[model samples]
Target: MRRRHLIAGLALASSLTALSALAAEQGKPTPTTKEILAKSAPAEWRRPDPQNLLVMQLPTGRVVIELAQDFTPLHAANIRTLVRQHYFDGLAIIRVQDNFVTQWGDPNDDENGDKDKIRSLGKASKTLTPEFSRAIAAKQPWTPLPDGDVYAPEVGFSGGFPVGRDPASGQEWVAHCYGTVGVARDVAPDSGSGSSLYAVIGQARKLDHNLAVAGRVLEGMPLLSGLPRGPEPMGFYADPARRTRIESVRLAADMPAPERPAIEVLRTDSASFAALIDASRHGHNAFYPEPVGKVGLCSLSVPVRDAKPVH
Candidate 1:
């Protein structure tokens, strides 16, 4: 009986080894994110519309944001107006909540701040019909992830932004992924004026479908996330001196042609991007012998690169 059992175990091991060899012969492992990007075609990249690009100059470096006008046109327009009016210029980054957000706006707008010192909104509307979520448009680019979400019925990328969707309601909203920029508001839904904004330093998925996502930060996230956390509750800085001052905020359209940021973003609908998604799911290497077959909505980051000068 012992001899028979040993022979059976040996046969099973031989079969497993054969299966492994067959699998290796059938397909090569998915390329790494870096390798996939290196092979991407120039057509896979897109230059953002100047009107939708915001250049926020900070003490450390420049932070570029691309407004998702298709999702929240009103908020985008309002933010554009505020930017044109220089509403954010000279304002300070008032809060840096650990593992939450890096908020920037008029310091006087806070609970501990002097109401009288609040900066004027100028021509921008003080209140807007809250654009928390909008009806999903069929024409919009949709790169759906097979892996289901915890919050919404489905999750995907629309126009380079991580988005959550509910087919039952036909509503889609931007997910609060890392580097997502959201409009700050009071309890009242109409209170958001696009004057104050916060960038997610962590995956604050709970905020999805709750806050209006103004845009996504394309560059200079380290400058925003690397700041010291505030001593006050909710990351509000008690001492004004701790806040980082905003040098200026300008729309790319307003800048000189030569001075505009020479940058491009990988198109979410491009083949390279789809490869990236697959790579995130199944790519394996020496370090990671086993690939995690599922990828979350916020785990993917659309690639951005400095545009090569047209010779």
Candidate 2:
């Protein structure tokens, strides 16, 4: 009877252990990106300075851009001068290259348009020295991406911009990713005056070193990128009527304090951002049998949120 009792007791203990192991397995599912962000601390986000924010209006919607003042101070200042003068108010989106870029400027300057009617630059300069890339000093904030890049020795984020870096040459420049705003220049390298800007809507790694990346479109990217492609060569619109009109472009700081768009961008160095990256690296579920386990420089879109509204 004692032997029989010992066998039954051992069986019961084994069953309980199995049940506990099953429960532990059920509770250990990998957290998704949504879950990680939901658990993020408040301090992990930062509100962009009003001085750095640009609010642009089109017939379809508003586009918010964060000027890279630290990376391209001259260009930022030039762009600010143009905005104050309302240089972009009546201008239009003149070109959209399918899987490439959407360019906006005075319609008369392009080949299809009459150069005789080119709009005056007003207080803005006609040209400036190229700020295509800058020396990568230690003072520059870098949040390095671990994955290898095809273009450069190192790739990372600096001041909310995707950047490629070369420690050997000590040079770093913003990578040409979707929604990156680049200054359109004439044949001369220094001809870019920020009068005309192009937003990358598709893959354009080739333009990284050639053009000066001024800023990034934080909002209304779909409105710009999803527009119909131009029929003319190099994405120029043969007819001015087909171009999208620019209603206005205003600096956020220039607006009333209450009317300024309240925005908070997730800090790249935050714990949440680390989690976001790690999740992208090793996350797996029933839907995905294979985890990518690697992330590229441009694959992660920086998170920005509307903090509050005036109304």
Candidate 3:
């Protein structure tokens, strides 16, 4: 009787093992984002130049921006000067117009704050030549997107920035997709001096020619995008108490090596980058049996990752 019970137990265990195997087989196999990045070669990643990197420390976290120096050189230079002069320190995020922009600068410039106490731009220029768009030439690196664009004759990326180009007009400018930082100015075209900047937190593509895109947020977009929406018109926070203050803005070059944000951005020209784009462009999963094969220009944000210091 004991031998019989032992045999029965062994049979039950075998049956349960087979059932578990079948359950595992029932699930579909899909390669995740993490898996793809893991397979990327070391050479596929590039570190941004310290000279062009802006480290904005907010109350919530650190936000890293890569200045689009190629498109807005003068604004880039002035912004760097302003950072070195510490012009952005203690400034508050004044407006968070939902689906528009998260603006920051001197609250004094706004109707809500004391205008007399506005911070000076110091040695930085008060105005710069408008860099709204530049002539697209053969010398520039080009990686055109696969699908047709709605706003421009062609859409693609160049130097890590999403670009909209008109071959006929020979003009190319950065798009105002999420995390794009633009220089705010008055009615005049050349009024932007990089003193006041706004990050694109919503669909503000209409502001393309109306403003100048100076940079793209490389990291910490959540710190800007996830903030509570302002109550006033155009998303301005009516209550000054509700605004988030800037702790400091530092050029990565000015910071100590230990203090800098060490990150690796996937090279848009690399084969791995092409693979990444193709993954989304040709992705098919259990949930999405019919692949959405075409990806929009704005949706093609290159992947960025934090990296350990080289020994």
lDDT of 2 at 140: 61
Question: Model 1 — TM-score against the truth?
Answer: 0.90
Model 3, position 274: C-alpha lDDT score? 67
Best by TM-score: 1
Residue 201 accuracy (lDDT) in model 3 = 89
Error of 2 at 234 (Å): 1.7
Off by over 4 Å in 1: 1-30
Give the TM-scores of the predictions, in the order they appear.
0.90, 0.88, 0.89
Note the residue pairs that clash in candidate 2.
Answer: none
Comparing 1 and 2 on lDDT, the stronger one: 1
Give the alpha carbon lDDT tens digit for every residue of 46-148 in model 2. Answer: 8888888889899998999988887788999999999999999999999999999999999988776789888888999999889988999577667888888
- Please give, for residues 1-311, the per-residue lDDT of candidate 3 as tens digits: 97865553322111112122244235434344456678779988889999999999998899999999888899999999999999999998988888889999888887777878988889999998999998885687688888877888898888888889998888989999889999999999999999999999888888886688989999999999989888988888878899999999999999998888899898877766666565556544444445566778887778899885789
Once fitted onto the true fold, the runs of candidate 3 whose alpha carbons sit more than 4 angstroms away are 1-30
User: Candidate 1: how many backbone clashes?
Assistant: 0
Best model number under lDDT: 1
Pairs that clash in candidate 3: 97-235
